[model samples]
Target: MTLILALDFGGTKLAAAVTQLGSREWLRYERRLSPIDGNATTDLAIMRSLIYSLLQDATPDAIGVSFGGPVDFTTGTVRLSHHVPGWENLPLKDLLEKEFAISAIVDNDANVAALGEHRFGAGEGYDSLFYITISTGVGGGWIINGQPWRGNAGMAGEIGHIVVNPAGPVCLCGKQGCVERLASGPYMAQDAKEYLFKPANQLQGQQLRSLVNDNLDLITGQIISQAATQGDELAIKILQSGAWALGVGIGNVANLINPQRFILGGSVTKAGEIWWNTVQKTARETALPEIDFEIVSAALGDDAPLWGAVALAESALISK
Candidate 1:
């Protein structure tokens, strides 16, 4: 049985799996969380261990990798990681090929996940789709004509930086009211924390305060969702704004690309009925009547990117 090796270098975690060329399931799998202070070196070491544990004595026909940040797809070099340092201009593809003596393909997490969905998940029957992840940050990837469309410089599908509210809060990308600034988990928590600190907004998040036991800093996107379900006004409002931002971004994307579907994944997408309803309603209102599309949750969830790595490896084997 020919084997394919898949590796995922998520900013917060790493995973490696071995699978047969035509199989839908893994033959062996290993995963580990990245250390809080890890750099490129430590992350690589952890991934290597997982690979060894999963590989045993068998050799993979091809390898595919998914990284969490920007990458030079043509050369398989990682530009940098927003969450971890020491990844600047790392020639990941070359190193992997040298280590394993086989062909390897690497791409950013968003793009890989999009490919995974198109190949095996919600986007299977769709020729054109956009995949969005809304957890620690908001990002997107496009699959057009059953092919991953990584724009020139592989910087396409950056829906997170779409400025939905130009006068609103500043994003890490140094833009005001970028979708990520309002819709990401960390940003939502930060917004809640900052609001509760003020005297006037004190009564607003009473349930949120109770959920975090008065530790405003303890507020997270999940916590906000829980509080919203329990009827926390502050949580609802913050979540609504986030959902609105994402909705506006999606609306614009629908108009521009007119993709068949939008598949949303990641932790923040689980923010209960309030968030989903807001997104759906606002997107409907924002888009022009002439444009139509559907938005759905990703079927592969957190594993989409890893599965996409499998697809990438499969493609390499097929081409060879």
Candidate 2:
């Protein structure tokens, strides 16, 4: 069957899938995540294996890859990721096409995810929308007129790097007080660890941990959510604090572009109303009330970026 080969290169995981052009049920592929300290070479090798394994029989025509960091669209070079090491300006598209002997397209992961969500998920039917992913780090994507907008230099929609506080914690981008350093999942855990500091337990040392015995290893974003669910005061306060920062970011974006809808995604969105409630309150206080807009969680889960990869391939093919 005619299909698209898609890949999502994320900080924590990599996923590849074969999907029909216009349907969700046609999705199928193998997925894997990077082990701690996994480098660029390891990720590329894993991707190559995944493509071969999933498309052994499908014989897809083109390959699409959505990378999790700044990508040069003209040259398809990845400009490093905060979580992944050794990914500085790597020529991913050329390498992929050379290896697989198929046309390949690559772009920013969040931009691709925005396309996917707009076309098939929460942002569907909206002509103008913004997508923000609050995970280990914040990432953003913009969709205008039913397509992704990769601005000149292909660094558009990097909302996470927007400065929220001049004196806040430093971001991986080497800047202090960027939105990501304030509102991302890791940032939330960091705040929790600082506020609820116990000499015996410290969570920031580990990436993600369970919440038990004040082991610090158990105080992950997930554990924080669970605690918040159970009305844990510390957990609720941390999320609320992050939400205020996010609301400022979102409001800032809203006041600037005022898109039709602002869609929220990433692991943090699983907090449901906990995050959104604060976002709404803060955005209203900070943004222009007259600007009509709606906030919603992205419908696509982990699959958002994969569909976006397909969109990248499709866009490239059509443009060609």
Candidate 3:
């Protein structure tokens, strides 16, 4: 049996799996959360442990890696990770090939997830689709004409950095009102914490404050969502603003590419009906009536990247 190994180096987690080529199920799988203070070395070590545990003594025909950062697909070199340090200019593909003495392929997680969706998940029957993840950070990937579309320098599908509210707060990328600045989970949590810090806002976020037990630092996107569900005006406002930002980005992307579907994944996507409704409503309002498209949840959830890694491995084997 032809064996394939897949790895996902997510911003907050690491996963490794082994499967047979052409099989839809994994033979062995393992996942672990990334350390809060982890860097590239720590993350790599964790991944190596998972890989060894999954492989046992078997060898795979090809290995595929999905990295949560910008990568030069042709060279498999990671440019950098916005959420993790020490990944700059790393030749990940070459390192993997040398360590395992086998062919390995790597790409940006978003791009690989898009391919996974196209081949095995929500985008399976669709030739053109866009996949967006809205958890620790926001990112996008494109499937155009039934194939992954990484534009020049493999930097395409960066919907997160798209300017949605040019007057909004600054982002880590030094841009104001970028989609990720407003819509990402961490940013939402940050915004909530900042708002609750003011005495003037004290009367507004009662439920939000209660959720975090008056500890502003304890606020998170999930906490905000919980508060919103409990009728906290401040939390509702913040969540809706994020949804609106993502909606604007999605609408603009739809107009630009006119994809058949938009597949959304990640933890933030589970923020309940309020978030989902706002996203759908805002997207519809932003897009022209002439445009027609559908927005749907990703079928593979957090496993999308790993499955995409499998697809990458399959491609590598075919190439050889």
Candidate 4:
């Protein structure tokens, strides 16, 4: 039986799985968290351990990799990672091929996840869609005419970097009011932390403080969601702000691409009805009346990248 290996170098975690050709289920799987201060060397060591554990005496016929950063798709070289250091211009595809003596395919995590959703999850049966993941960061992938479209430089689906509020807070990318600056988990937490200390906003964030036991450092996107559910004004405002930013970005994407659907995934998407409702309503309001689209959750959840890697590996086999 032909075997394919899939790997995900997610920012916070690493996952590896092996599956037989044409199988919908993994033959073996392994995953672990990346170290708090992990660089490419450490992350790679963890991934190699997982792969060794999963492969044992068996050899994979092909391999696919999903990296949580920009990648040169044609060369499978990782450009860089915002969260983890030491991953610049890493020749991942060549390394994998040399290590395993087989062909390997690699791409940015967002693009891989889009391929996953398009082939077997939310975007299945849809020829055109945008897959956005709002987690540690916000990113997007595209499907045009039933195929993944990685534009020149493999930077096409960068909705997170899209400017929404020019006067808003500056992002790590040095842009003010970019979608990721306002909507990503760390940014939301940072905003909440800063807002709570403002004297004029004293009346707000009471519930948020109570939830975190007055420890603002404990705030997170999920905590903000929980506080919002419990009627915390500050938390509600922050989440709504994030949702609004994402919604506006989505609206602009809709006007530009007019995709049939927008598939959202990642941790922030778990913020419940309020977040979802806000995004839906705001996007509708921001878009032109003529543009129509559906926003839905990704069906694969955390496993989308892994499954997408399978599709990528399969593509490599077909090309061979």
Steric overlap count per candidate: 0, 4, 0, 0
Q: Which tens-of-lDDT digit does each residue in 1-320 have in candidate 2?
A: 55789999999999999987666754677889787889999988898888888877667767888898889988888888767898998999999888767788998888989998987899989999999898887888999887788888888888888887888888877898888887788778777777656656553333223346646645777777777877777777778878888888888889999899988889988875786899888987878978888888889888889888887777766776
Q: Per-residue lDDT for 141 in model 2?
A: 92
Which window of 10 residues has the lowest lDDT sum in candidate 1? 198-207
Segments in model 1 whose C-alpha atoms lie over 4 Å from true places: none
Tell me how far the alpha carbon of residue 220 in candidate 4 is from the true structure, in angstroms, after superposition: 0.6
Query: lDDT tens string, model 3, 220-251?
Result: 89999999999999899999999999999999
Using all chains and alpha carbons, the TM-scores for the candidates as numbered come to 0.99, 0.92, 0.98, 0.98
Evaluate residue 99 in candidate 1 and report its C-alpha lDDT on the 0 to 100 scale: 95
Report the CA-based lDDT of candidate 3 relative to the real structure: 0.93
Q: What's model 2's TM-score?
A: 0.92
Clashing pairs in 2: 209-217, 209-218, 210-218, 211-218
Task: Report the Cα lDDT for candidate 4.
Answer: 0.94
